[model samples]
Target: MPDVRYVTQGTRAAIRRTTREDGAEFVRLARESAAFHRPWLTLPTTERAYLHYIGQLEREDREGFLVCVRETGDIAGFININNIVRGAFQCGSIGYGAFPPAAGQGYMSEGLGLVLRHAFGPLGLHRVEVNIQPGNKVSIGLVKRHGFRLEGFSPDFLYIEGAWRDHERWAMTSDMLDQRTGAG
Candidate 1:
């Protein structure tokens, strides 16, 4: 049975805020998906580490959501909107990961679309940005499909896996999303 507490629902997937209860399952998925996530991500795969990871998400500036398969209620991925800035700049940075059995099944795509809606609607965010490693073509394609514009390139933008990495900055504003969906 699908969880009735979905924050947003799509055709094949639903997203809900990630909680402490998700740690064990998330760790299992992460550990199992290690090969799929290497170089691009370094998620917690142990229970203790997972709890610590979850703790950081319990902040005013962060929103963590799990993308669940609507049919089986299996966790397909996770999306997080971080560094929320209110006041003059209503923006957030989005990061996500798609796990095994759901990586290439379009579930994450559908889930991401729902997340964008939630971000613009209830979250009241005007702009959202994704900074991805330059070599990560799959991630780049995902943002492109979602109508995020290629902003610029940032060299040594983020430190990952003990080294500075180059990143391509992609961004989408509420207006851009509106225009894409012909809702503007």
Candidate 2:
């Protein structure tokens, strides 16, 4: 195993930038988490796809991180900041999922908190958005817990699995994070 450089740490989990070396582990984890993610999102489950994903994350407009268990150094989940628009916009969209062993364990919550701090503090992002299907109560709850507000709904917002899926847009700003954490 290569050295894992954590970008940020929380009590139970840490976030690290995703790397090409993470391909195999991510594929296995995707398989393990398939049932949990089937209705919500899709992950790279093959080596080629994983490599492609790594390439995508390397782009300037995107960033990816793996949420790892702090004690055991195991991958608990992944979060990606995508479609970043710099300059006057300073915004990004995010997608994420938790692996089975970490599911419902609050690791993702800690990881998300760390990621938001990283985004607003170091990355200089002013806003982050998430799109969730209305039926995905767990995901909805996750964003709400982090203080994301429902902005609107989009018909056929994304193409997923075998069809176009409708999504509810949720967003949070740097000011919101600062207010939530009392850091502003």
Candidate 3:
């Protein structure tokens, strides 16, 4: 069982760490939202696969979170901080997926904002990067709305759905987040 930490509470949703108990609901949501995540993500839709996925996230370098509806506690989306690096370079790469019922509901936006806060605050991460495929306008827009700046582009940056895919690198530093929120 993974430790659960509440990141933030929003008007319609709350962001919190993913737990083993969420396996059934998470797999159901992933299966139902397959069309919405096809080219961009490959979420686990089966019980065994879901457990394996969560186990991987339990590793030291990765963190997983879920965005849930405040009123119902239903999962709306998920966010992951992967490849964390400490020491002088305190950073991580982020990936996310919004489920069908919550795809255009703005829950992801609220959840991502909370994730950023947690990442910069208790996590002590200095930077977070989101690598999006150029054609993924929705993903790009989400990061842009949160003030991520375009850092560069990578050819065949990652393997997705089989073939290597290109990606546009967008990043936000802790300093940038502080500047945006006027925290410091």
Candidate 4:
């Protein structure tokens, strides 16, 4: 059994397990960022939708979710390492969104690094992928900073903001992770 621990940056921000206690805060951030995220995110039904989303996170397979917090304990973002696959592939994809207030603060970047390490190391995953909207320069830069390579582009890859949009595929393998540490 693997454990999900809190990740932090000095005393500024933290990432930890999502809990029922976070329901209200999560809902607030999700709603507040609806406009900013509507272009890339799937629409939710209601305020309680996060409860259902949290339920999915408890599964032993398929998905995992985390909550990002500011030093003041405000929930600022959400991240997930989902669609996990094992055996021959040993892969998964990352998805995330930050509240309008939290964007550009490097909170997601720090959280991503911590989670990706666990995904490849303790989880024994070989590859992780990120599908970023071509127009989302912030996300593209984040993935690239983490050593993910641009694999290709898929037109109409995701249906977002009412129509299908192109997404650039980026991937990082365990070998690539190792290379970053001179262990490959």
Clashes of each: 0, 0, 0, 0
Q: What is the per-residue lDDT of model 1 for residues 66-174, given as tens digits with 9 covering 90 to 100?
A: 9999878899999999999999899999999999989989999999899999999899999999999989999999999999999999999988777898999999999
The lDDT values for all models are 0.93, 0.93, 0.90, 0.75
Q: For residues 37-108, write the lDDT of model 3, one tens digit per residue.
A: 878878898999999999989999999999887777778899999999999999999999999778889999
Instruction: Give each model a TM-score.
Output: 0.97, 0.97, 0.94, 0.84
Alpha carbon lDDT at 145, candidate 2:
99
**Higher TM-score: candidate 3 or 4?**
3
Q: Model 3, residue 45: what's the lDDT?
A: 88
Model 1, 74: alpha-carbon shift in Å?
0.2
Over the stretch 1-184, how does candidate 2's per-residue lDDT look in tens digits?
Answer: 3225989788889999999999999999998888889878889999999988999999999999999988877999999999999999999999999998888999999999999999999999999999999999999999999999999999998988888999999999999999999998
State, as a TM-score between 0 and 1, how close model 2 is to the true structure: 0.97
Candidate 3 wrong stretches, greater than 4 Å: 1-5
